[model samples]
Target chain A: MERTRKPQQERAKKTVEAIIEAGFMFISRQSKETLTTTKVADIAGVSVGTLYEYFGNKEEILDAMYARFSEDVTAMLREVTPEVIRKTPDQGILHILQHLREMLSRDNQRYLHCAALLSQNLPEQHVAPIRQVLATLSLQYLSRNPEYINLPNLPVMNYIMTHGGIAALVHQLSSDDPMVTFDELSQGLATMARHMIEGSRRDAEQANP
Target chain B: MERTRKPQQERAKKTVEAIIEAGFMFISRQSKETLTTTKVADIAGVSVGTLYEYFGNKEEILDAMYARFSEDVTAMLREVTPEVIRKTPDQGILHILQHLREMLSRDNQRYLHCAALLSQNLPEQHVAPIRQVLATLSLQYLSRNPEYINLPNLPVMNYIMTHGGIAALVHQLSSDDPMVTFDELSQGLATMARHMIEGSRRDAEQANP
Candidate 1:
């Protein structure tokens, strides 16, 4: 019975991993328009019916990939502790940037392309989980030390934190400049956050009236 | 002979315009993945040979559409002069935002979708002409009157004048908040500019030593 259950578990794991690898492969060549169960099955070296047994359709596979990707990103953010962020906002932002760059580099361009496609195509849905992670991380650090940042509207700050950071990341990934190293990308994030903090105080003052 | 030439000229003009419109329609629904010459010809109510006679392939049709669409945007920008930019950057940004909204609104969403698809699939050769037009227009207004602003680095300043301005416009376009009006978009641009300018100055001072 133990041996029977072991085969079943291994088969399920292999099937799920194959579906996700196929999904990434499909997105790399084309944007959201080219995704299909048949294409994924063909790429994954599996029968279309077997693929359907694992996923209802392309959207289900994509949704699963999104959930898995978000979990990975969140895990990276969690590795940067509150103590690390307490040192400075710059350090926090740089740490996150380096972590993202390392993760993207490990896949040799697939992760970067997938991240850009998701951000562009499914902004509303895909942004939510990432935004939640950023908000939790941002608030945890900022609330403990109001000296670094003081603002009236927390939601707007959250918006800037998530969108501005992601925008900088996406720009670096999509740029054709091979000489633009990851250090510059990290510095860009630090610059973005510092600018946001410095400006938000004045905006808060003006909005109060 | 003169009369014959006039009629032939008119027919050629109609065929070119019809092909462009059909390309837009095809991109609006299916995107660049499903783009095909036969489908474009069918939609344009022209023969496949006629389509080929006018342009080489789908890229040629896309090039024509991009040139025309970019000119439309330039014309809209020219409608707002340096004087408008001087009165208030926020007001100027608002005027341009509303103009773009109106321009895309006329097509009832088809143009916006087609434009987004084209942006994704644009050929490398098409970038230079568009950049030249944008840079010439942007420098004509923003660079001529530097006393009105205080950004430190000229290159970064020029970059902000182009990328930051466009980013603000795109953010507003993609926003789901119905309550977020053009005025809010303008204010956002102004806010982005104000912060980045300060940050640039800080970087400049650090670089000088």
Candidate 2:
């Protein structure tokens, strides 16, 4: 069934929010594999029929959760403005990393579910906007730094490395048998980002000179 | 359905080999989602019943293919002996990276599938052995280098960094719109590995001295 018409009324909106909250709470407490619509309804203290009224299925509920997550992350990314990057690149990197770490640590199991969904070959509609936002932000940051200006395809490189690196680190951090402490993983990746930028700058200089 | 008994006769063994070869070929040619027993049997020039006689389902076929891939990778890792590592740590690093690049480039789709499976919270029985083998190899390489011996939790560090880095790179490389060329990615990662090892050694020296 198609998703129930968006909850427009105040009461309906509260019901939707409750269901989404309950969905994320369930994800945090258990693996995605164990989640069921009935369980979500019970957790939300709503009728099963009411839950179905909003979400067509569990996957739809996950899609909604994922959209919320993307919005949260994108909002966080917005805080890393050009001014902040220009003032202190290192601090800016740390800020982003710290926020990400906190987000992942908040509910690691839920984060894993989000990771799995994001990592899949999601439709362009679901993926493109977030990637565009990230790429645009990375471009802004790179352009502000003279050293990074000459790096070939700086925008794409920044997007791939930063996004891929973050995804990998998050996956490791969320795993039951994480190898490194959170501090180590974050520091290591920050170091990597710094070095990659510097390394490419060096390469560009040698090639041009 | 229960999996077929292991082939005891030479002819039956050949049939199983043919089926597995067909399975990998299908995976390489198309996404795993599209693979089916009938298609695999057709590709292998075997009856559908014969395919079922050897494998319980599509997942079992994937499991067999994964085992084969693991064996191939483990064999490559075995070649990174103490002598090779001691002779030139840089060369050993490049060797491993080159082998990984080749394996990934050989069948990008299949590699992605394997990565997804391995990255997930797979059963300990399925994950532990592969991880143990990789960790052992990483430990061997790290220990043979005197500078790395003093690094904190060297074995675990090696495992996490190496595995995480490889996974991140593979994901990027296999992507449709890859950010960096294969040469750049391999070089960048090799540089990261070298720096991380040397950087840790420097820290250790500073702390001890």
Candidate 3:
């Protein structure tokens, strides 16, 4: 009985993984227009019924995929080393840029296309998970710097950097002819981060004085 | 003969204006999904064929309406007083915010709905005019600050801010629950503009030193 149950559970987990992977592939390849349960099931090597059994429908699968992707991003953000945070703003920015370059370069089209679809299609209710992905990454960045705590509205500033910075980068990346090159994008972000740090430092000094 | 023809031409212009105004009203009252040539013609008190005679299609009418809207915005931006630009960052931001509030508040649905429709439905070719709109505004802003001319790769920075800034703002404003309020959004842009100015200043001082 135990051996039969173990095999069944493992098979179920594999099926779910296949479904999620297939959904991501479909979204990346066909954009949002082709995101139907039938196509996903066909891509996953599963029946329509099996797909429905695993996920209520297409939206449910997408929601699960969104949650998983957001969680992965949060996990990556938390993995930033303490030494990286303690470095000067210039050095810290370099490390952050390096990480972003590696991640985005690995799957540029997939990530960029997915982001475009989300920006276009996702409802207000769905925005929170995406925003949380951003807020979590930002909070993690700020956690390493105690000096910035006393600065006026640290979270608002960080939100501007992460959300606004990423928003700008994504728009350029999605454009037919990107004006900002990959290197320039990274450097620009580093510049913004450094300036923001410097501005907060000035605020901190003023508050202390 | 010339005087008689002038009144005829004037009558044609008035008819076209009536069609466009009715089209705008139709889209504002009904959703974009429901907007059609027949419906617009019915509202305009013209035949469907007459509406098509002027517009050729729905997109052409939309383009006309958008062109008018852009002209209004351009006139507003062009009117930015020298004193407004010379003010402190926070105060300058507030000035812009007040203007934005008035523009956005009046017929909020019109701009919001049209923006949503364009980002999703318009083809790649349609984006060029809007991009030009952004470029013109940036050029006007840059020309105001002659000091920024000598910066390395200056056009690239302006492109980032104007193209990326407009894209980010539109996407956020279109979202279900926007991340930034009008005041916050305007201040965020001001902070970025101020930082860019300060960074350029530092670069100049360092270069000359």
Off by over 4 Å in 1: A1-9, A22-43, A55-68, A78-87, A107-124, A139-142, A146-161, A178-181, A200-209, B1-9, B19-68, B78-99, B105-143, B146-168, B178-180, B202-209
Candidate 3 — number of clashing residue pairs? 0
Judging by DockQ, tell me the better candidate of 1 and 2: 2
Q: Pick the candidate with the highest DockQ.
A: 2
Stretches of candidate 2 above 4 Å error?
Answer: A1-19, A34-58, A80-88, A105-134, A147-164, A194-209, B1-5, B9-58, B80-89, B104-134, B151-160, B197-209
Residue-level lDDT for A156 in candidate 3 = 50
Give the range of the ten consecutive residues with the poorest summed lDDT in model 2 chain A.
A116-125
Candidate numbers sorted by TM-score from highest down? 2, 3, 1
Tell me which of candidates 1 and 3 scores higher on TM-score.
Answer: 3
lDDT of each: 0.64, 0.65, 0.64
lDDT of 3 at A126: 45
Query: How would you encode candidate 1's per-residue C-alpha lDDT over A1-209 as one tens digit per residue?
Result: 22122225787779778878988988988767667788888888888878777676667788877776677777777887555567678777787777777767666667777754654454346656776788788778877777756564345434544555565455546555622455765665566556656777667777875
Ranking by DockQ: 2, 3, 1
Residue by residue across A1-209, what tens digits does model 3's lDDT show? Answer: 22122215778889888988888788877776558888899999999888777676577788777766556545555566455667765676567666655565555545665665544454434444655665665555567766656666465565566555655665666665777786777677666566656665665677787
- Residue B37 error for model 1, in Å? 8.8
Highest TM-score among the candidates is held by which one?
2
Sort candidate 3 into its docking category: incorrect
lDDT of 2 by residue, B32-130 (tens): 667889999999999999988889877788788767766666666676555456645556666776776666556554555454333332233444465
**C-alpha lDDT of residue B156 in model 2:** 40
